[model samples]
Target: MTAPAASPALRRPDGSALRVLVVDDEQMLTDLLSMALRMEGWEVRTADSGFDALTVTRDFDPDALVLDIMMPDLDGMAVLQRLR
Candidate 1:
């Protein structure tokens, strides 16, 4: 017999608030990521550029950040460096 199907994409059992920041130069990818994260009942924010990511980090103060390695103006490494 086949095993049970996979559960939902996101699982928030503790009912804790999750703040996420997604940074990518590709608008489509960013939108998709944001949509998926939000579906998990998480607070999601997206930044399409390095500068924007910095700005968002300041204001959004996300608990976690998903950033592309290569981005225009500011790459992920550079951003991480600046944050440090």
Candidate 2:
């Protein structure tokens, strides 16, 4: 199978690091994705629920979000709507 598309590169004009936030209730997948993001030289954080994610989003102010579609409490779409 083909690999998933690469996540958009988050960079600074000064060539500094990027910040990433990963939200997924699946602990294993979140951990794996966090590892990959860290390898890309990003500061990564994760949250296991929508409530927690919103808190993280506020605190982290991530340059990009890696969100899961299915989650307990609230899903990614709902979270995105609230963000918008």
Candidate 3:
């Protein structure tokens, strides 16, 4: 049998592997997504609350972000707004 297809490659402008931040209130979901992204060879970080997300975003400055809209302590929308 042929080898399984590889995941699509991702890169940043500087030619480094892409970085991603996943924000959600659920620890399980965050852990799951972080594991998946890491398997794809992407840098991954996770935050369990919006407030923590904002702080991590500022420090991490990831290439992409996956956010949950409904969360305690400054929802996703507000986080996006503050970032903008």
- How many clashes show up per model? 0, 0, 0
> For model 2, what is the alpha-carbon lDDT of residue 34?
97
Which model scores highest in TM-score?
3
User: Which lDDT tens digits does candidate 1 get at residues 1-84?
Assistant: 999997754434566668899999999999998998887788999998888999999998888899899997999989888877
Question: Which portions of model 3 miss their true places by more than 4 Å?
Answer: 1-8
TM-score for candidate 1, residues paired by index:
0.79
Instruction: Report the Cα lDDT for candidate 3.
Output: 0.91
> Candidate 2: which stretches are off by over 4 Å?
1-10
- The superposed Cα distance between candidate 2 and the true structure at residue 56, in angstroms, equals 0.3
The C-alpha lDDT values of all candidates are 0.86, 0.89, 0.91
Q: How are the candidates ranked when ordered by lDDT, highest leading?
A: 3, 2, 1
Evaluated against the true structure, the overall lDDT of model 1 is: 0.86
Please report the candidate that would top lDDT against the real structure: 3
TM-scores of all models? 0.79, 0.83, 0.87
lDDT of 3 by residue, 1-84 (tens): 999998668788787889899999999999999999998889999999889988999899998999999997988999889889
**Inter-residue clash pairs, candidate 3:** none
C-alpha positional error of residue 35 in candidate 1 after TM-score superposition, expressed in Å: 0.7
